[model samples]
Target: MRKTTYLLPALVVAIVVVLSSIFVVDEREKALVLQFGQIKAVKEEPGLAFKIPLIQEVVRYDDRILSLDTQTIEVTPSDDRRLVVDAFARYRIADVVQFRQAVGVGGIRVAEDRLSGILNAQIREVLGADQVTSDRILSKDRGELMIRIRDSARVQARSLGLDVVDVRLKQTNLPQRNLEATFDRMKAEREREAADEIARGNEAAQRVRALADRTVVETLSVADRDANVIRGEADAERNRIFADAYGADPEFFAFYRSLQAYETSLKGDNSTMVMTPDSQFFEYFKNELSTNGSVTLPDPVARAEAPDAPAPDAPEAPEMPEPFNLTPVDPAPVDPAPESPEAVDPTPEAVDPAPAPEAPEADTPPADN
Candidate 1:
């Protein structure tokens, strides 16, 4: 029983010692064995590793790629424009031994802090170069600038046993004051452009109006010329018609013209005129009067009481006596007639005193015949 108890305790002690001496290194981690706070061995591969128990310690470090985000920094470009820039860096430990030597107990946090400073410094150096401007930084050239930053940062990070893979600017912004000023300037430029466009539009409208006015004037002038030509043609046609009518019957035309003149002159009851009786305007009236004065008329009562006249086909009748064979006489002289009462009157008897003559007997033969 004593021997068994002694073997059990010894075995337990041996297991504890073995466990303390043996350590596991994961694939994702790099480990360093330290003795008296001094690095002794490094285990970069995975699986089991051995270290002296109670005297040696294992330090582990991440082997994978890491990210470092820098605080927002203000940088001035070559154009002297200030910008707020936020950036990040991708890095990995190229030499774990060197990394462990550089930051012994401070670990990844210390390495990251130091790396952030390096990144910020490089960013300022490359972005603030003489050829770099705010416009270039904000454009596709920004990629070139980032490359320069990464190159510069890699050189500085080598001392910290870090390999810089890339440096990139995440966000870029202008100061609030500058943003407002830029907006105001853009607005003013747009307004000026709008004013110029309006002025050009008005000029075009004026040209159109002038052209329309000219067209209207030309149209009216053409229409007037055509109208005058047509009117002259119409007048010539009317004059030709009048000439042909007059040539057909001059005497009848004259008589018709005189009648038209009388109708026109005596349109109303109050019509009056003062002219000599022998005026050519009264030629028809004078001829009628002369005929009435020269020929004697037969009484209507005597003609009714006489016997019926013979037919045109019967034999000739005997000659009439001398008293029945009345002849025409000359007209008497005219005296000055009253003005107001007679001139206004339209009675037929007042116009002429001699009665109308009767027709001759159809069956009787005349002396001249």
Candidate 2:
């Protein structure tokens, strides 16, 4: 009975000790054997691991890839342009022994904090290079720039036993104040360009208008010159026609001119003229009277010169003969002379005159004369 009790308690104690010494390491995790706060063994592969009971303990960590999201940080580029950058990293605990030594009990949390700082530093360094600009950071080359950032971060992360797989810029943006200022600058530039375009258009329009005006003036000048030439030719032709008509008949032309003068002189019914009867204007009337055998009146000058001539009652004067036409006519006998001149009355009523002759027979001789 005593042997059974001792052997049973010994077996129970052995089982407890064995159970405490063994620990499980999953495929997704790595295990660290710690002896009184000191690292004794590292179990990287999956399955069961052993440790000294009551004197040692096992610490497990994730072996799979991890992600870390960094806080938004402000960085300035080579051009002195400030930007807000947000980034993320893909990493893993590459050296678990080194990770335990460096991080101690803080585990993945401490590792993440240190790696995040490293990534932020490298981001600022690569993005702030002299050749890098804000435009390039936001351009298609961003991927290549991120690769550089990752490589730089990896170099610094080696001390922390972290394997930096990749680093990527998640978001990039300008500050709110800078964005507003840029918008204002762009708007002003566009307005200036628009004004310049309008001015150029007006200048071209004015040039075209001036050219059109010049063309119109030139065309009008040419037309007026041609019209004047045509008018001069017409006037010359009219004068030539008048000259030819006058050369054809000089007498007819004179007669026509006289008639035109008469028309001009006697234009109205109230017109009056005071001219002598013996004037050349009566030449046509005298010729008609002579042709019809009518006696012509003596000129006023001849009557005035014959004041001492014989009177009509005196018989001493020879009888006058009739004027000839185609042949001569005989003279009539004269009475005995009364030498002294007969007493004559100077007044118009004293003499008994012969009967007035008709207009057609005024030139014929009287039988009693």
Q: Please, what is the TM-score per model?
A: 0.60, 0.52
- Model 2, clash count? 0
Cα lDDT listed for each candidate: 0.75, 0.74
Q: Which stretches of candidate 2 lie over 4 Å from their true place?
A: 187-369
What's the alpha carbon RMSD for model 2? 23.6
Candidate 1, after superposition: displacement of residue 92 in Å? 1.3
C-alpha lDDT of residue 34 in model 2:
88
User: What is residue 167's positional error in candidate 2, in angstroms?
Assistant: 0.6
Writing each residue's lDDT as its tens digit, candidate 2 over 245-334 gives 445533343344443444444444355565554445433223323456774643323323343444233123234344312221222333
All candidates: CA RMSD in angstroms?
17.9, 23.6
Task: Kindly report which residue pairs in candidate 1 clash with one another.
Answer: none
Show where candidate 1 strays beyond 4 Å.
197-369
